[model samples]
Target: MATQQSTGSTLTRAWANTALPTLGAILAVALWWLVTVALHIDPFFVPSPADVLDAFMRDPGFMMNETWVTFSRVLIGFGIAVAGGLLIAVLLAASWTVERMTMPLLAAINAVPKVALAPLLLVWMGFGNSPKIVMVVLVSFFPVIVSTMAGLTSTPADLRELGRSLSASWWQTFVKVRLPWALPQIFVGIKVATPLAIIGAVIGEVVSPDHGLGSVIVGSGSSADTPLAFAALVLLAITGVVLFYLIVAIERLLVPWAAAIAS
Candidate 1:
């Protein structure tokens, strides 16, 4: 009976976790549908769900192509950001001098609204693809650095002492202890960076490229095609969710021990 009760409680918790937010979202959409349909508002002002879906269906191939364009830009930029951020974090973690010298400058640059710099990127990199990718790297770079540094430093003091007693080299200690401890936190930064990467890519395309989902939104807005704009946005949201979950899946695999502990 006790085992059954525990199982029931777990199942209830899982259902609540899945249902509550989904219920809220459905209710919100129904309200929007009612307002738009009942009031007979201009579809151009606030498109109905069906209109957006219809627009999506009308040019599914075209939308898919634009989505691929944006996805390529985001992945390239995010990949570069990951490689560069890890390098920077490793170097900074190793050298207090580097941390002290570079962190404040990094903070200042990160604080500058990267979106506003899109036009300048367009001028420098032009409308093809490089600017969008560069902008994505710029936008996603800082969180990775900050999260990684904190995670690296967060290695247990006792663990370091143990490593020292074992006469482990700095590389040995970091590889054995610091990096593993940092993985979860590093994944947190990655989760934060994913959407930022998407936003950066789209913003870059908006200001520069004549292709990609951002370009579709830009083109739609130019003609005041609300449904098309909304459709592009829907695609963007889907891409972000998919990318975020992919990272999550990778994290789950690499950090299964952590997951087991959590369970």
Candidate 2:
């Protein structure tokens, strides 16, 4: 009976988790359709769902291709940011002098508007993928660094003492204890950065307008094809959502304790 009750509870929680969001999305779409109909909005300005669907269906292959382009850029940039950020965070945590010397400079650089830098990036990188990838790294880097430093520096005093008691070397202690503790917080930063990486890719694409969903949106806007623009936007939204959830799924698999705590 206890086992059955436990299984039933787990199923109930899973249903609630999945069903509520799906229901919410349905209601939001219904509301959007109603608003378009009631307001008698111009399809050229703000398209109805059916109009957007038609636009998507008109050039499904092109839309998918652009999406893939944008996603690939995001993946590359995000990967670099994660690797670089974690390395920097480790160095900063290991040395107070390094953290003090570099933190302010990093903050200043991060303060510069990414959009403003896009044009300069084009000049320097010459309309290549480099600028887009760099933009993604810039946008996504800080969160990871901050979260990782927080995690590493905030390792419990008891844990540190325990490591010392075990006569562990600094490297051994960090690898065996500190890094594991930091994993959850590192995942937190990754989840936060994932969407920003996509935004950075889109911004780069918008500036260049060479290819990607951002370029598609730019082209649609130029032609005043609101439905097509909306379709591109829908694709971008789906991509961001899927990527974010993919990261979350990874976090759950790799850091199950964090997921349990969060739940």
Leading candidate by TM-score: 2
Per-residue lDDT of model 1, residues 156-263, tens digit only? 889989999999999899899999989888888989999999999998988875899999998998899999999999899889988999999899899877755545
Please list the C-alpha lDDT of all candidates, in the order they appear: 0.91, 0.92
Q: What is the TM-score of each candidate against the true structure?
A: 0.90, 0.95
lDDT score at residue 152, model 1, on the 0-100 scale: 96
Give the least accurate 10-residue stretch of model 2, judged by summed lDDT.
1-10
As for candidate 2, its clashing pairs are none
Tens digits of lDDT, candidate 2, 1-263? 54565677777978988999999999998999999999999999889999999999998998999999999999999999999999999999999999999999989988999999999999999887899999999999999999999999878899999999999999999999999999999988998999899999999999998999999999998899999999999998999999999998988888888755555
In model 1, where do residues sit more than 4 Å from their true spots?
A: 1-28, 260-263
